[model samples]
Target: MQFSIYSKPSRKKAWLLSALAIALLGSCGKAPVQNQKPATEVKKAAEKPAPAQAEAQTGKVVVYQLFTRLFGNSNNTNQPWGTIEQNGVGKFNDINEAALKGIKELGASYVWYTGILHHAVIRDYSAYGISHDDPDVVKGRAGSPYAVKDYYSVNPDLAVDPAKRLEEFQALINRTHAQGLKVIIDIVPNHVARHYQSLHKPEGIEDFGANDDTSVEYKRDNNFYYVVGQPFQVPKPQNGYQPLGGEAHPLSDGKFEETPAKWTGNGSRLAQPDFNDWYETVKVNYGVKPDGSYDFDSLPADYATKSVQQHAAFWQGKDVPNSWLKFRDITFYWLDKGVDGFRFDMAEMVPVEFWSFLNSSIKTKNPNAFLLAEVYNPALYRDYIRLGKMDYLYDKVEMYDSLKLVMQGTGSTDAIASVQQGMADIEHHMLHFLENHDEQRIAAPEFAGDANKAKPAMVVSALISSSPTMLYFGQEVGESGTLDSGFGDPSRTTIFDYAGVPAHQNWLNDGKFDGGKLTEEQKQLREFYVKLMTLSATEAVFNGAYQELHTVNKTTQGYTDKTYAFTRFNDTTKVIVASNFASTATSFALTLPADLLQQWQLSGGDVELKDMLSERKASLKVTGDTASVQIDLAPLESVVLKF
Candidate 1:
């Protein structure tokens, strides 16, 4: 059953519940009296040897996504539609060694530097030989990062010197690598800005649609589809909206000239797309004709089981469409510059064949490159990972959606077990996250209304499987995305305007890269994230076998729908995780199923359970096919117990 997204407790109730949660936060890891056995007795019982799995441990990946333009900006002058000089933009140089070191300390192996690509911003850079973007087509003063204007260049606004933007980006990449962390950037293959241009393209490389026969609606080699005889007409302003908050600009006359208009980024074939359409960008053509027939070669039926090298060799001598070749070259350019990988935007909108060709090429250059995609459909997850050769796909539809429901108090923790069991075959390929640029922050009023409420959910998302865990920049310190940034509404961190993240700024601490100004609660929250993330990345158990205990413990004493339990074990370490999603304290007997106990070869005895994140200790009683621990969980508390 689907849970209602809008269902929430009353504001007064929520505030009181959250306050109680914060007050009890210090005791979340405390051991219960019933389970707190003598140290001598617990240590003696824990000395019994357990069987170890023969399989070698694989390391888990932890990703930190930072909005490049906002991460280093210290400005709190949050005036709506403010100019760059007023709002202040963070430069590439601002992400110094100290910043990289700070990120590394969070146990992030890869840093996804978003909005590094050149996009259609409202600001003029004619002096730097860049053409001006019309304010009518741009989303906001800063424009959408997905509306890429140039594939071969970095955003000029991100550099101290606009003329040396590429060099500055390269230096940042170097700094990231120096900190023992890999770098990731965006590669939007599905579409491009309506006014696409490539001033710095390599010799003999033509810009998109440069060689197209615009008189016709479709061509196999054309980079974009056309609307035939219709010229482009901008969508009328809706809800009393105007460019740059009604401020007058030279290009704010609600006019952008495009003869023989192309299809919009969302595949809207109309020359005059609806106001809600993605009107700022145009879709790219990848040999799919107007009649919905693919003109390009399809992959072999057996290619699903083949390696990336095999897929690359299959297209070695075969001719590809111009759009495919152009994207391949664009990716190669970044890979050559030491960029570790790409995060493809709206990947499912593009065909699987293009991904097979492009991703295979990327693997040929850097076999270890991280290729993540945004694929929301559950049925296409396997196809995208197996046939398309993607390294990871956002686990939004199942994992993230279900967890959000539980956190919002509209769903049961039982639903999480079902979701995990269903995706067991491909769990490792799924990437888990609580927040991104596109989603509402956990601490936002529209969501859980308190950052502390997400602690239990974060635990399950990060440690439930072998998948990578991604954390947004300010999520650690609870940056509620409630600001009314220009052209972007509240409840999500804005990607379409210039703004400073207030909570992130507290940790940024005026370029000191310290949490000097953070409150006690925020500091504790960050410390919890550091410990959890570091374990997720370094612990071998996270990369090993997982068994759900929630289903078996349903009838156990004090176990309710609001509580969940699970275990992760490998050759060397075994852990039990218990979480309480309720806004009040809970007491339960967390159980270990007979099958799992058999796998670990613990027949019967007392076992020591040490809280990994705190100094609390507990005792597990295992009696002939039955093993259980009495657990006490505070509001929104999650404990990782190691035996």
Candidate 2:
């Protein structure tokens, strides 16, 4: 979701918005037929699914974060800078039962469907009563999914019937549940698309910035910040750029008209934002004072110890902020449609107190609702987890970064212990993942340059702690992410443009949802992933106690900086995990500490330990107060030994 973190924007390009298409770009150089639903039928719920009952059956979550716009795309015409006409987009209908079954076979319990919200795109939906978005503000022929245009409607590009998009999405949700998979969608509360118009808002709800008092720069009740006596002007294209690759349109004149310009999404007050800024959207206000003070009441000191009902009652009669109510209503609307959870985008940008109100209300309604937040600050991790009532936060800076360093052969295996020990108190709240939409692909040249290198990292990320694990759509199939996607480079998939993923398309196998076209190496890599995921989901020891053997074996004979070891066990099962991050094969005697031996009640003799990843058994030679196993590991290999 970030545009080159290391690259800073110059003053000239800071105000320029990357111009895209003014009309919708359908795949295959042909306009898709738009089906219309009858006006009499409306999307309504039949009955609520009991989440508590479902949670009892579903132990831990293994999320497959599928980019909805690109997941089912089968097009292979990967012409660089190609329009959507050349590279077709995936629709909701493409997520058929076979697709869900394929994902389920990968041992996924939940599907995080990204980009389901109705965002501002350069599509000409004028025939369906929807206006076209200006290419001057849109990111690509498609649009940035984070720049939400409507809070109540589903993206029309994802449905067969444009008018019945919400119903089609509901059917998708139902189908996902039929395969025993829960659905999670993104909720961007920090900002909305610049042309924020909710065409399908409920009867009583009003659109954002509609009733704002535009005379002043800041108001407690206002939804947006305005530049007094100023008019909005589009920034001039930079770096030899032109809208839609020089495609001309009447509205692409770089002359957007806005009297009393509003603040940009990144809090820039400039009348025209540079291309590097989040200019396509506008920031939302939550009653914060101009001097960085709170304008509304703060939470009481003892709010953490209160019940959900008590927290809900605390704000019953109080005059809360308007923005808070709008967000709460939006969440309620999604929950009514059977969305099992939400992944809040840039959640740390907003105040944590609002999350207290919003998340508490959500948990009150469904106690098992998954609330995952994108928070990167280490200092605020505890506050967001305990006070904000979030279920999980991304462990990116610590575990993911450290593992990436190990994958690149630049870091010591000893660092994994510190990352685990530091988060010991709140480890369950830290969600682990090697690849997401924002990070680089594992097989990309900028990363490890190989997907097999992710095995050890995936082992620790999934089984080291009792937290949830996530995998992006193509991570399992070794997607190199080296495509010259229009707006996005090769290291990451294009979220802003329309394109097909190469490796993922191979697995799509012409909509068969089977790995019919995969090579031998790719098929083996996928099988390794399937085994890892299945073990993580079905193992009893995954939820048990954790102990680090890496610290003890760092100085042991045959153990080097490229190796790591750990153990997890409860009363019934004891599992030992060992990994080698080196490029060459090595043999080592994995010696267990005396404390671990006593914990597992092992005496000096021979014990059988089974390797879960390779399904090979080995005998552990036990001495007086310790146990040791002779292991031969392949390059970048990891093993899970169970007794």
Candidate 1: stretches off by over 4 Å: 1-58
Runs in model 2 with CA error above 4 Å? 4-59, 305-307
Q: Report each candidate's C-alpha RMSD, comma-separated, in the order given.
A: 14.1, 8.3
Residue 596, model 2: lDDT of 84
On TM-score, the candidate that comes out on top is 2
Q: Write the per-residue lDDT of candidate 1 for residues 218-313, one digit (tens) a residue.
A: 987899989999999998777788889999999888788998999988777899987766788998988777656666667766889999999988
Give the lDDT of residue 373 in candidate 1. Answer: 95
**TM per prediction:** 0.91, 0.92
